[model samples]
Target: MTTSSAPPVAPAPETASTKDPATRPRRRGRTGKPPSALLSRAGVTALLALATLYTLLPLTWLLLSSTKSREDLFGTNGFAPGDEMHLAENLRHLFTADDGIYLRWVLNTVAYAGVGSLLASVFSVAAGYAFDKLTFPGKERLFSLVLLGVMVPGTAMAIPLYLLAAEAGLVNTFWSVFVPGLVFPFGVYLARVFSAAYVPDEVLEAARMDGASEFRAFCRIALPMLAPGFVTIFLFQFTQIWNSFFLPLVMLSDQDLYPVNLGLYVWYSSALSQGHPEDYLLAVVGSLVSVAPLIAVFLMLQRFWKSGMTAGAIK
Candidate 1:
């Protein structure tokens, strides 16, 4: 006998750990997140919800108040719906009261936002694409100046812009609002980011090799790819031009040229000081109506924003 068969030859060492992949404690990813992380996430979500409630509370009050009679607004709970809904009557009075001046304001808003955003987006896209793809003297310097302009708040430049418009005899005219809205530094910056990311150099080179002129290549090849970015720029500028208050206030003395925001402000001021505080309800209703188009536009165009960001990032 070979000395008890050398103790039955111990099995080869397994080496691997006994822990199973599924059963073992996770070292990374969601399973690895500590209870503290979960608690932190919960805290963040709750904070955001509370912030949303805070922001929306005034709008909620406005809606409820708009439905109530003057007496009910003062007497009843602020959030309670009144016994009667006068929103329709209020709207009718609003539209018909001033010889349909409100409609003109609405049209003016549309024109300013539409024309301004379109022109601004075109200018921004062209400038951005040129800056990114074309090599020119002082390109970096010009871009840096644009960035500096971004840092300067529009309010600070409002007086200067007004003065320039005044000198050019543009004040109190639609051009006062439209032309200023069309020159957006932020739009230019966004366009540059998008152009750099989307319009690949190789593609431009190929287009040039095909004997396509620079403008032709851009119009035919690059512009299609830039469509998403254009929409994003348009939406942003649209919202900005639509919501602008101070510029319009400074530029135009004629109430007929007012956009919805300025028009609403007029109502609010009148409602407060004119002692017909009951008219406040109309102001609230008008506010609600004013925001509806913006919400609709965002919902419709948000897909373009997503696609554009994705396209640029992927490229």
Candidate 2:
């Protein structure tokens, strides 16, 4: 009985790394430190600094140049601050000239870009959702036309849009510029991609089972899923419409309805061609004023914009 009791012994268990060193991950250094990064820290910092300088150079020039009067603009050094910093005077002249038409131009830009982009986002999302979830004849054909539209430059459509506006008696009115910015084909395409990727079919089916109409189901169940996509499309359309020039040039004749870009262009042109070189400073200041809203908008909505762009890539 004593001999039998001594017969049983347990063997030690082999852990993963001990069993297979080749398959196991490499360990950290003796000090438990990670390996060197791809880029040296100092080298990476220097690269970023150079990039920052490259981007800021022009803006820096503009800032310094705006501070100069017309005389200083030509007479003094271009990059350095002039002796008489006339930024306040330049701004005053900018708003006061042409009976304060610059304010009207700014307001017109808001209507054309801000309001138009909002409407475009809604239409895009709705059309995209319908194209994805609903089955109808000619749906693919219609969507193909949309894809075709994206390849055509907005400039190429200006004459045709102008012709259409003339037919509708909308020429030279706010509606001329406001309406065109609202019809972005690429936005609809992007919304479709986001819809198919984000909105779940099973949830929509359940909403249908709960006696919800198609519109109600979309409004209640799907729109919230598409909100991020809307923000992305809105921002894109807003910037496009905001920076637009030729479309408004061809569509509108009333300077009172000009967007800031077109208005500054007229000023810069008149200043250069008409010998009122003093207005050049006004043009520079207006440019800075125009850029401020875009910067503010990006800063405010960048959180949603970043998330929206990356959402469909994951699922």
- Which candidate's lDDT is highest? 2
Task: Please give each candidate's TM-score.
Answer: 0.84, 0.80
Q: Model 1: residues >4 Å from true position, as ranges?
A: 1-39, 83-85, 308-315
Error of 2 at 147 (Å): 0.4
Candidate 1 overall lDDT versus native: 0.82
lDDT of each: 0.82, 0.87
Q: Ten residues in a row with the worst lDDT in model 1?
A: 306-315
Instruction: Give lDDT tens digits, candidate 1, residues 1-315.
Output: 455534577777754344456655646657776566536878889888999999899888877777777677778999998544476667777788578887888899999998889999999998888888899999999999989988998778789999999899999998988888888788889888888777778888888999999999889887777888888889989988888989998998999999988988888788889877755666777787787788899898888766653344333
Worst 10-residue lDDT window for candidate 2 reads 306-315
Instruction: Report the lDDT tens digits of candidate 2 across residue range 1-315.
Output: 355456667888988877997978888878897766637688789889999999888788788887888887888887978544388888788889889999899999999999999999999999999999999999999999999999999999999999999999999998999999889899999999989978888879888999999999989878888888888899999999999999988977789889999999998999889988867777888997888888888888878754643245334
The true-versus-predicted C-alpha distance at residue 238 of model 1, in Å, is 1.3
RMSD of 1: 4.6
RMSD of each: 4.6, 6.9
